[model samples]
Target: MSILIDGLLAILAIYLALQSLLAPRLSQSVFLFFAFGLALALAWVRLGAVDVAITEAAIAAGFLGVLFLDALRDFSSTISEKHNNTEAIQSSASRKKIKTFLLPRLAFGVGLGLFLLISLEAIWQIPQGGGLTAAAESMLPESGVEHPVTAVLLNFRAYDTWLEIGVILLGLLAIFVTGGIKIYTKPDVVAKDPLLRQVILFFTPVLFLFGAFLLYIGKSGPGGAFQAAVLWGAIGILLHLGGKPVFAMIPRWVGQLVLIMGLGFFLLMGFVFMSGGATLFEYPKAYAGTLILIVETLAAISIAAALTAIYANLNQMKEEPKENESAN
Candidate 1:
């Protein structure tokens, strides 16, 4: 029964992935991509990596899904404008160009096929039932967390986790640089549906409570900082869609502090520990659990802020006017 379920999930995942890539319409592809993420999340759960599954479902299906849908809306509008200008030229040339790169397309397809075969071969060659499970289990008692995944992420591999947080901050920085630091401006038109308002009210508190619950639960279960951050970040997104724009209401300095608190505190702790003749991020066994909890809490807040900022910036972006429109 378990094997059959796994097989079904595997097939669904593969089908969704292929359809998402090959779908002719942007909206169809985006929806298919969401399906693929959910399928992949289920696969992760079946593999017993619930932490990974949660993160995958939240970030991929939830966050990235919203981003992709927004992008699709923006892209569709831009394409519509361009199509009006180039429809005649494109209509005449589209069919002629269809077969122009036949050989190159065939070669690219063949290359992809070979790559897939090579990847499968490599997977099959990997040794099974040989990993760091035994070692991790042995060290679990001293790692300051009962959950092995939490232990590995917060203690055993603290450096990598720290860098992961840094990467998220850097991604937000990149977005700011490219998009010119869009502060959340209130939309000219806000949705005033009572049902939508009710839904937002219901979910807002639920997400906040769940995010905090997940952060605390990470010490013993599948929940953690990243999962909690996604939930918290989602609250901001929900509010934005509901016309609240919570991030925009906050003072700029406060926003900056919240955004940096996680990474900054993490580095400060690392340096403090290093002063005690220990390496960076190597917490003393006596205070490890407390330190990990603090770091996780702060990291969750910072991550949530960064994610909300990214979404707000993307959501508020205005389409640049075309030359003809500008002249008019």
Candidate 2:
């Protein structure tokens, strides 16, 4: 049964990948890429890697799909019939007149020789990263999570999680500091297309249920803070794009405080706990589970807010101010 499922999923993945590569419409290709991601997630699950399946599903199928759909909608006007039709003309001309590289023949020979030598060395080199059994075993007890990857993500490699949060927050800040904020309610942005509105309405409830399930299932298998939060963020972005939710701005102070609160809480908790000197962020073995839960909750909220704020700001930048025609 498992082998049959894996084989089917692998074939689906290949089909989606090929469709994505061949599709002429950019939006169509983007959606095919999303299908490719979903199929890859299924392949992971079939291979008994539930944790990787969930993470890939969240990052690729959920978050990335929403990003591409929204951005492609914005670019739809910029891509018109003239641009779409020019490819055929260019391809025919290119076939008729294939130009040689302007590089000197001697330099081309030297470059080809160097590339062959490097390719041979690369083929012969032994990869060092395949063995993680020792690291995984050492961290598993400290992780309190069943999946080794989740354990590493939330506990053993918590520092990477901390820095990734910072990177996301920094990206949000940079978007705002530039004129990239479109903080008004452009609720009709995607509603202008009824098909998208229908799609969003259909998927919103499913996403909410799935995201919550992922969060609840974290302790046992693959689902966890990052995956659940990303799913939530994708749902929010979709609803906002579909005219169901309006983008709004809060006071600068509130935004800044919320932005850092997760990291601050995490760092402070570590300081308090590690004072006994096992290591930084170390809780007593008895309390480790509870402490990790607290940290994950904060991390989830922080990531969701950071992503939603970016969506709000991007809309703010694109929106035109409307005059108040409200009743006097």
Candidate 3:
């Protein structure tokens, strides 16, 4: 039964992934990608990595799905505004020509086949039952957290985790550079439905409570900072959709501070530990668990803020004026 279930999940994941890439319409591809993400999450669960499954579902299916839909909307509007029917038809014909080109398709198929064979060979070469499992298990007692995943992430390899948080901030910075630091001065044009408002009211507190619960439970289970961050970020998105932009209501400096709080605190703690003759991010055994909890808490908050800011910026992005409009 387990084997059959795993086989079905594997097939579904592969099918969705291929379809997402090859779909005829952009909207179709985006929706297919969401399905692929969900399928992948199920595969992860079957592999007993519940934490990874949760992160994959939340970030890939939830956050990225929204981002892709927003991009699609902008892309479609721009295409409609900039190109007439004749140009659109010509472009479509050119794409069809490229798609039907025999030589290019043949070469791509050959290359992909070779790549798949190489990947299979590499996977087969990997020695089974030969990883750091034993070592990690032995060191788990001293790593400060009951959950091995949490221990490895927040204690055994904390520097890597710290860098991961920094990377998220850097991504946000890159988005800001591209979009020129858009601060939302007003709420987005959301639907003025009473049910939408009611939904937001109902989920706001629930999401907060759930996010905090996940953060606290990470010490012993398959919940952690990243998972909690996604939930908290969802709250910001909900508020934005409900015509109450949280970041817009707050001071710019305050928003910036929140964005940097996680990475800054992480580095400060690392340096403080280094000053006491310990290696950077190497917490003393006596205070390791407490310190990890504090770091995770701050990292969650910072990550949530960064994600919300990203969504807000992307949502508020205006299409550039066309040449005729600009001339006028």
Candidate 4:
């Protein structure tokens, strides 16, 4: 029965991947991609890696899925509309070119297939996990965290996690510095829908509570900063959908502070430990859990804020000028 379930999940994931790749409309592709992420999460769970599954489901399916969906909506209104009329003219011209291009494409496809087969053969020849599993388990007791995964992420592999936080902050910087996105000066119109308002009200507090719970349990279980951050991001999206921007009332300096707090604090702690004659991020055994919690909490907040800002900015760009005018 277990093997059958795993086989079914693998097949479903493959189908979803193909659908996402071949879907003509951007919206359909985006949703199918999200579905693919969720299916992969289930596969991870079946393999007993709950932490990875949660991260995959939350960040991939939740955060990235919404981001793509919003971008697709924006694209349809801005660029796609302008090209709609010209598409027919382009189509006729493109068909003649496609016939001429088919032979080359078929040749390229055959080459790609051969390359992939060779890659898979090489991967199969590689040795399976041996050293890392034994090392992690042997070192787990001294890591100052109850869960091996948490200990690895917040302690043993701290540098990698720290860099990931920096990458997310960098992404927000890229979005803002680009200057193509505009913040809405007015409330969004979606909040006016009574049903939507009620739904947001109900879910908002639930997400907040759940996120905090995830953060608290992360040191001992599968929940962690990334999962919590994604939940907070969902909260931000709900607020935006309800016409309340995530940082609407936040002052600029304060907003910037919140955005940088996670990465800054993580770096500060690393340096602090380094100055005490230990290497960077080498917390004393007694203080390891405390330090990890502090870093994770602040990181979760920063991640949530950064993701919200990104979504709010992108969503603002999607609102039709007519909606703004009507709101006015």
Candidate 5:
């Protein structure tokens, strides 16, 4: 029964991937991509990788879908109908030519068959059961977190997590350098609908509360700082969509401080520990768990702020044409 279930999920995932790849409309393709992510997440869950599934569902599917949908809205009006029709006709002709070419079809089929055979062989070779389970379990207590993945992320592989946080901050920096931080300050001229506003107002607090809960439970469960941070970022995006500039309400310097707090605190913690003769990022066994929690909390905050800043930059970019038009 489990094998059947896995087989079904695999088939569904493949279907979603094909749909995402073949969809012509940008909006359709984005939605299909979201569905593809969700399908893959389910596959991950069936394979018992709940943490990976959560990240895939939340960040890959939900967060990216929202981002793409927003960008699609911003550029949807720019598409020319005549150009679209011309492209459609050309694409149709090309499809016919491809169908008429038997040799090309045969070559494509042979290539696909070879690829599938190789993939199946790779899957079959994967060893059944856990690798490094004993090693991880033996060192779990020293690593700070009860969950193996959490321990690996926050303790054993701390540098990787730190660099990941740095990457998020760097993305925000790039956005800020390209577009000013005041992007969120400009008012959203198109007022959001009352129903949307009401929904956002009601859910914003709940979102933050849930995100905090996720962060707190991450040491022992599938939830983590990254998932929590994405949730908070999603809330910020929702608020923006509802015509609220939450970032603008906070002082620019304060926002910047929050954005850097995670990386700064992480570096400080590492250096302080190193000064005590411990290796960099080697949490003292006595305070390992506590330090992990503190770092994760701050990292979540910085990540949330950075992601919100990215959306704000996108919002500003979308409004540039309107500003230029008004100037004209």
Candidate 6:
């Protein structure tokens, strides 16, 4: 059974890779890749790797799937191209001229060959020296978290996580900045969908609250920064799709300051620790939960705004005075 399951998963992964490479429409590819992620999570769980499975399911299956779909939506053609689910041709007579594509093919082949050669050596031999499980076992008691990976994420490799948060913030800033120049349009109106609209309106707030709850619970459980951020972002997306007000065109200073507040405050906290003769970001256990909760909440708010702004790129809008001043 185990062998069969693994083989099926391998086949699914191969199929997903091909679908992504060959799908004429990008949307199909993204959703198929998401299915691939689900398969990967299953495989991880079978291997007794819960952390990797959670990451695969939550980070890749959920958040990455949404992110890719969002990107596909953004790249939507001027006219919606409707595609039929027709059987794909297995062999192509020819595709775009080879001279233009040959170089990329050659480069990809070389890269894949080298990667395989390097990877095989590592996979075939068992490491005789330090192993991750041993290191994690040694560090768990000192980490103050039951889950080893969480301990590593928050404590052992905190600086790495902090920098990653910075990268996320930068990516959000770039999206918002570039999105400002984008033409914003209201989503297509659905006719006589009062029942569905009412249903959505009724439960949307509840969902938002649930997402917040997940984020808060993350401190003690399998959830955390990424999961919470995605949930919060999902609420904003739902609000936007439901045609609710989903933007805040604040002053540039306000936006910039809000964007940096999490990192700024984190750095200040680190400075305080360092001033007390502790190393950089060597957060005292005393302030751990409080500091983490604060950072998480701020991050959630900033992330929500950035995600909403991706859809609603309202540039700086001048307030319109009452009625006929311009006409006069």
Best model per lDDT = 1
The per-model lDDT (C-alpha) reads 0.87, 0.73, 0.86, 0.85, 0.84, 0.64
Model 3 bad stretches (over 4 Å):
77-100, 319-328
Count of backbone clashes, every candidate in sequence: 0, 7, 0, 0, 0, 0
TM-score of each: 0.90, 0.72, 0.90, 0.88, 0.85, 0.72
Q: Which stretches of candidate 4 lie over 4 Å from their true place?
A: 77-99, 319-328
Per residue, candidate 2 scores C-alpha lDDT tens digits across 109-191 of 89999998999899889677769879798877767766676667767777787788888889888978885454456578578
Tens-digit lDDT track for model 4 on 119-216? 99999999875658888999988888888888888899999989988999888889877646465454557788898899889999999999999888
Candidate 1, poorest ten consecutive residues by summed lDDT: 76-85
For candidate 5, give the lDDT of residue 237.
Answer: 79
Query: Residue by residue across 1-328, what tens digits does model 3's lDDT show?
Result: 6899999999999999998877666777788899999899999999999999989988887699889888886766333422454565566666666556556769999999999999999999987877888889999999889999999999888888999999989998999888877657566455388777888899999999999999999999999999999999999988888888889898889988998999999999999999999998899999989998999999999999989989988887764345338888
Candidate 2's displacement at residue 36, Å, is 1.5
> Where does model 2 exceed 4 Å of error?
1-15, 76-130, 186-212, 238-252, 320-328
Q: What tens digits encode model 1's per-residue C-alpha lDDT throughout 195-214?
A: 87888899899999999999
Ranking by lDDT: 1, 3, 4, 5, 2, 6
The candidate 5 region of ten consecutive residues with least summed lDDT is 183-192
User: Which pairs of residues collide in model 4?
Assistant: none
What is the lDDT for 55 in model 5? Answer: 83
What's the lDDT for residue 22 in model 5? Answer: 68
What is candidate 3's TM-score against the reference? 0.90
Per-residue error (Å), model 6, residue 240: 2.0
* CA error at residue 180 for candidate 6, angstroms: 3.9
Decoy 1 TM-score against native: 0.90
What is the alpha-carbon lDDT for the whole of candidate 1?
A: 0.87
